[model samples]
Target: MDVACAFPTTLDTPDNIAMAESLGYVRAWVYDTPQQSPDVWMTLALAAQRTERIGLGPGVLVPSLRHPMTNAAATATLAALAPGRVSVAFGTGFSGRRAMGYGAISWSFMDAYITAYRGLLRGETVEWEGKRMRMLHPAGHAPARPVDVPVLVGALGPMGNEVARKHADGLYVTFQPPEFMREYSWVPYLAWGTVLGEGETPDSEHARLAGGPGWALAYHGAYEFGGPAAVLDLPGGEQWLAVVERSPAEERHLAVHSGHCVELNEADQAAWDAGGHSILTDVTISGTRDQVRRKLDDLAAHGVTEIVFQPCGPDTRTELERFLDAAGSHLKPA
Candidate 1:
């Protein structure tokens, strides 16, 4: 399996991308939550300038946040800067939109958006807002026609998976077990929070704290999809539901931003802690080095082609280095 690092698009993102490249990570995925981090495309442009071998792109850009034309142009520009080292993943808005007090875009919108975006990237004119448009750039200034960029779709449900299979090169799923992917056929790119410390097992407190935010994200996703009732079946789901129940209806959507591993505030951290530590063991790959290696092997054997590791905690660089030390041998050449 190939390893990728997902960053929060902070000021240090380019630095981290360069470090990850040197450490043998295959890709660097920048998050697109504009309210929380720097501009994702600008960060990616810096990453492209800093790193030579690693792939760089938005882990999943929200289609609703920008016009398909804008996304196509920005991606084409990045592809020009990085040449063959660019790939993009699109998704219905999550933190990027919800943080702005909106819900995810409809699947139909995403399907149409991907179609048009792909067409525009290939230097073909695509109909947009009742008019046809194409990226206009001089031959030497932009990537040549038929830009070879792989587009993936970030999805969590059956409808999203279907859209990805139909319109995208692959599927980017979060917190899904390998067995789930084996049952549903698609090129799988799995994203999980990874926490590795000396002598710490998957159930350790340190591990739980490191991986808890990812579980919290799953809880939030479940609630968004099916209301509080949908998440009741998950471990510690009742607690998350209770928290949501206590919030006023007007403020509930903000809960979607509660469990981000990269920007957990005190309140969010407390809420995640209340969800119980074992929730981390269920949703994340957290353990000692040998245990993490075993988990990586299991994921690869079950059909995961890429693992995008979201390293959490205050010292991200340390966490990333430890994660690479444990699993870097499994990284396939880009």
Candidate 2:
């Protein structure tokens, strides 16, 4: 399996991506949480300039955040910088929309948006909002049309997988690689958690910092999909619900999704303290070097072509380095 590193759109993205390139990572993907991090395309552009071979793009672009014309331009601009190294993926919003008190978009909307977006990239006029639109960049204005980069869809259910099969070149998934997705030759899996050090336990300070944000996502996800009662069953779910309940009903989402995928906020810390550490060690990729390697092998066996790791917390570089070392053998494909 190919190994890649993803970033949380931190200021250190360019440098971290450079580090990944040097360490033999095949690609560097940055998240698209506008409210939390820098502009995903801008951060990716900077990263592109800093590295030569590693691929760069948003891990998963939330379509609701921008007009297709805007994304087409941004994708074209990055294609100009990185050429064949550019790959873009679209997904129903999670952190990007939830943090803004919005909800995920529908597959139908995404299909239409992508149709117009790709039409523009292919130098064809497409209709949007009942008007004709095309990438009108003149000579030296942008990469000559037909940007022709790979398109992927991040999915969690059959609807998304079906849409991907129809519209995207590949699939991007987080958990449970479905049998239907096996027909696609390539699939990318985004992994969470830290590689535990020798003799270190799951509750170690470093593990918590590096992987707690992902663990806390459980609370956000459970509550978002199901309700307070749904979240009350996870490790520390009861306390986490209590913490979220502290906020006013109208804007409680602000509290629930505060530290999403980047850091652990006060509510998350409360959950962590109330026995949520198990969630980290249990569901995330936190394990010894050997154990992490086995996990990658299992994912590869299940048809995951690429394993993308996003390092979180304070010392992200160190976290990346540790994961790199832990994924020693799996870094290269068979």
Candidate 3:
């Protein structure tokens, strides 16, 4: 399977993107939570200027965050700078929206937004929000219209999957088994974890720093979707429900997602201290080099075309370098 790298929403990410290019990752995708990090397209433009071979795009954009025309133009801008190296994905809001005190957008809304976005890119006057609009850029203003960057949909269930199958060129999913979608040739599975150091355990300080975010995200996502019951079962997950429940309901959203993928906030830290370590090693793809290589092969066998690994920690450079060493060289950069 092709190996790709996904990044947290941090401005310093372009430097890491460059590292990925030199190390031969097929694509470099960045998180698009505007409240948490730099603008997605701006970050991508910086990455475009720094790297030539690797692909770049937002891993998944929340439709509610911006207008279709805005994203259409941004897509064109990235296409102009990176040309064929650009690919974009849209989602019904995961972190980007919840952190802002909202839930996922409806698939029907997503269907219409995607239609308008794609239509705008084709240089067509598309009707959206009761008005018609089209890209009217001159040559050199933005890549000439009909910019053909691949579009992916961040989806999980049948409704979202149907939208992806019908309205997008690819699929972007998080925390799912490697399952092939027959309708599309592109499937990007979002994953996390670290390569264990010699004699290292999953609960080691390095492993927690490198992969704790993935496990914590489980609690945050579960609480958001199904409440405390959803999260109480995971390894240190029981601690998070009570912690968030103690907060005012209106502010609970903020409490759940604070620190996000960057570090463990107070509540998340409590959970981790309680027993969150095993969740990281258990759910995330953590192991030694040979073990990780075999897991990657298993991922490919199960229909994962691309493994979008998101590394965390203060020393992102080291984490990324180690991941590349484990991914081997078969996955060439775009």
For residues 147-188, what per-residue lDDT tens digits would candidate 1 score against the true structure? 778888877777887787787777776655434455444444
Number of the candidate with higher lDDT, 2 or 3: 2
Which of 1 and 2 is ahead in lDDT? Answer: 2
Instruction: Supply candidate 3's per-residue lDDT for 207.
Output: 81
| Candidates' C-alpha lDDT | 0.75, 0.86, 0.83
lDDT of 2 by residue, 162-268 (tens): 78988888888875567766777778888888888789877789878888887777788888888898888887887878888889988898999887887887788
**What are the RMSDs of all candidates, in order?**
2.9, 1.5, 1.6
- The model with the greatest lDDT is 2
lDDT, candidate 3, 1-334, per-residue tens: 6788998868688998998888778898998888788888899999999998899999898888899999999999999899889999998887899988998999999999989999999999999989988999988898877888899998878898889888888888786652446456788888888888878887888888887777688778778887888788766777877788788999888888887877777778778888877667667778887777778887777667888998888787788778778888446545
Error of 1 at 224 (Å): 2.1
Q: What TM-score does candidate 2 get on C-alpha atoms?
A: 0.97
Q: Report model 3's TM-score to 2 decimal places.
A: 0.95
Model 3 stretches astray by more than 4 angstroms: 178-183
Q: Give the candidate number with the greatest TM-score.
A: 2
Error of 1 at 182 (Å): 5.3
